[model samples]
Target: MLLPLSMLIVAPVWADEHPGQAQLVQEVAKDTGKDPAALNALLDGAKKQQSILDAISRPAEAKPWSEYRPIFITPARIDEGIRFYRDHRALLEKIGAQYGVAPEYIVAILGVETFYGRNTGNYKVLDALVTLGLYYPPRATFFRGELKTLLELPDNMLAGPLDTLTGSYAGAQGWGQFMPDSIRDYGVDEDGDGRIDLQNSLPDIFASVANYFAKHGWVKGGPVAARAQPDAAAKPLTVKDSAPQWPVEQLEAWGYGPLQHLDPGALSSMQTFQGASGSEYWFTFQNFYVITRYNRSPMYAMAVHQLAQAIAEGVNSPESATQ
Candidate 1:
């Protein structure tokens, strides 16, 4: 359920409360045709959340792959993803087919993002955006743009009343944890109910995720990532170079051969992780980069890939069939 809007900031505030707030109000009003008074009321109701600032300063993506992988790829998470897939199999499969994305990858996104919606977030969307947009100097310009976008977005694209909407510290909302721009660009109303309710509607949630991937060039039935057996003289790669720029043949010539049979001409890149056994290397493909578009971290994409693989395996196992 949505929490009540903070009453503390409900009192009317003028443009003088924060720097450039007046310009924001005027711009949003002109751009979106929203009532300036209502916009003021909404903006006044937003309280600065220091937690959001602190949270963004230390994102999970900052961690090494070994540490980051354990946070999302666990037995319980995989089990829950499998159950979610089974329960929503038909819809998942349909949406996956429509968008050319695999169902387990969709499920893995939900698992990693919000544990299948069990924890969409506790921060109010307004507070998260406002605090970061106005106070957080590092990315204030970006977050401010998001704050304006949130105000400008149509009601049909939102999950609920703007005052009560809750999401992550970074201002990402609903099941898929989309930011304001992502919602505007990629949100789907798969049920055709007029409103794109990412919170309660499974079709909207599933389809929105798939649509984002498809628009971002997720190849149908394409390989995501493959473990590579690096020869004694393999070239090293920093995490920064994870984009699929080189062909698999080029990587092979550098002593990084994929454990699986990937097309020699396929574009790929290498990512080295600090795993339990020591430094681990993997050849990442186009779909792997597509996953990174959701969260720009090689470790994040790897975790999703491994988790999706686990869930797909569980779905196909005889044990799952008996249940």
Candidate 2:
């Protein structure tokens, strides 16, 4: 998930001197074939952004589903989401057909992440990566790997210069807010321009998002989820893993079922959530689990699901909305 970086605090402690710079110089310079001194100098300009450390400690994902629901599932966001879906009808449908992911889920993802390209932050990507990579030892190895991949990206692919590049404090960027490695692996030239520009390219962004979900095992023309009710004889759910682990028959045997019939042996999971609307029970299909791959939180998944449902219900002929 993308963390907004509008409130970043610039700290300069690590800019002038970081003992680890020497090792970084040797490692990155060796990989990139650039001069070690140049690499070191670039890092010397990277400040240890204290805000990044502070921000990571309190991510939006940490909030309970009750509070988190209103943040993304608002009228303004939903209205804007409908407009975005209407504007990009054929394109979203085309890619949706290609990737097996529904359009609304893709649109909901964009809506939740940056309000459809309106708020991709202003933090320098280099500083964010460096600050998190060197000083934040908990995830330093991961951030350092992200930093290495960011350095490897071509200038054409970046939103701006490495030193002045702007993105999330965690270093994800562009319309989809992809991490550096995600861009490298899932990024595609949907426009066939021989370059993938996530910043300005809508086709690339749509395809990239679709590619991400597809790679994570999104099922085409399959179920996503359904509201469930426990029968009078229902037993306590023993399933532990978050994803779809038990068969529909097993869940049914325990006295849970959807309003409509499902393949008795199909894989799914029973989820009990304490949301803004109070406790709700659901049977999530495999595709719902795929949405969680984009953001691991169940709240995120539920918001996406409900938003997509709202969009889908509104999109008949009178209006359009992506899920």
Candidate 3:
């Protein structure tokens, strides 16, 4: 998610000329009671990176499932995930049991977000937040809110100095790509070190990912998704919404039947994606929706689900015994 800040479209804009600097500083200072002068200094030092603005406009989530699946789910990534699991099996299992989330899911999130912490990001968190929050109009409000929360974060909660911290172009920090709000809300200090170091601490990273899923209502042992086998006379369907409001029987009546036998009364939804083979249909369940809470894109949720399944199978496979 982090690209080098290259090609400055124009001279860097300072805080004096930023559109919403005064109001943001006032609000943050009032809310956190931090020195207004210190906050001003921080913003004054933040350069509005055009690269950040450009990156936000073209998110990978915009890609189709066929194109998106290969990026995160791959043989190399799966093998690495198996190794990561083996390296952290005891901690992953312990957290998974405590949080009621599967260990594979926790690993899958890290695998997708940062390739298991290999690439958290390089953009300065301050500049990224400031550029999007003040300069980008489409999501200014949301980014500005994130900016404020970052300033409000207590010293004990952060792993390093604020000015030096780096994250995604969207200002998400740590292995799980947590934004400021998520850091404040779901971040865990699993090591009891009094700091939520998602970048360096393995326990914090794994537990935080598991905690996010658990808090979002991940159903333990519930199915995430399944391939659908539409009858020749199957009623044509499109992905209208991701919510699992339709009963399994209802989708069956609509001509989209799950390949695996599921409880006919269970609530589910159908989604169609342009796959490599052809149009592919899937039956998504409640656990599938829980993954979407981490990333709104259905493709993202599907990729995570598929990767988790792949990694889980690989870990237990006899072939992995040699790994």
Q: Highest TM-score: give the candidate number.
A: 3
Q: In order, what lDDT does every prediction score?
A: 0.89, 0.81, 0.88
RMSD of each: 3.1, 3.7, 2.2
**Candidate 3 has which clashing residue pairs, if any?**
none
Deviation from native of the Cα of residue 199 in model 1, angstroms: 0.5
Please provide, for model 2 over 1-323, each residue's C-alpha lDDT reduced to its tens digit, 9 standing for 90 to 100. Answer: 56446444455644346676677767777777877776766777777777778889999878877888899889988888887888898999999999888998888888888899998776788888998988899999999899888877776666556687678879888888899999888888899888777778899999999999999999887888888888888888765645999898888888986778788888999888777677777888888898888888777888888888777666654534223
Candidate 2 deviant stretches above 4 angstroms: 1-9, 13-16, 238-241, 317-323
Indicate which candidate wins on lDDT. Answer: 1
What shift in Å separates residue 212 of candidate 3 from its native position after superposition?
0.7
> What is the C-alpha local distance difference test score of candidate 3?
0.88
Order the numbered candidates by TM-score, best leading: 3, 1, 2
Worst 10 residues of 2 by lDDT: 314-323
Candidate 3 per-residue lDDT, tens place, 1-323, comes to 65344634524546668758888889988988999899989888888778787889989878887798999989999989999998888999999999999999999999999999999998889989988888899999999999999999998677699999999999999899999888899999999988999889999998889999888888998888988999999987656667798889998998887888998988888888888888888999988999999998889999999999989998899988776
TM-score of 3: 0.95
lDDT of 1 at 129: 88
Colliding residue pairs in candidate 2 = 104-322, 104-323, 105-323, 308-323
Off by over 4 Å in 1: 1-14
TM for every model, in the order presented, reads 0.94, 0.90, 0.95
Mind giving the per-residue lDDT tens digits that candidate 1 earns over 24-100?
99999999889999998898888886566777989998888778888998999999999999999999999999999
lDDT of 2: 0.81
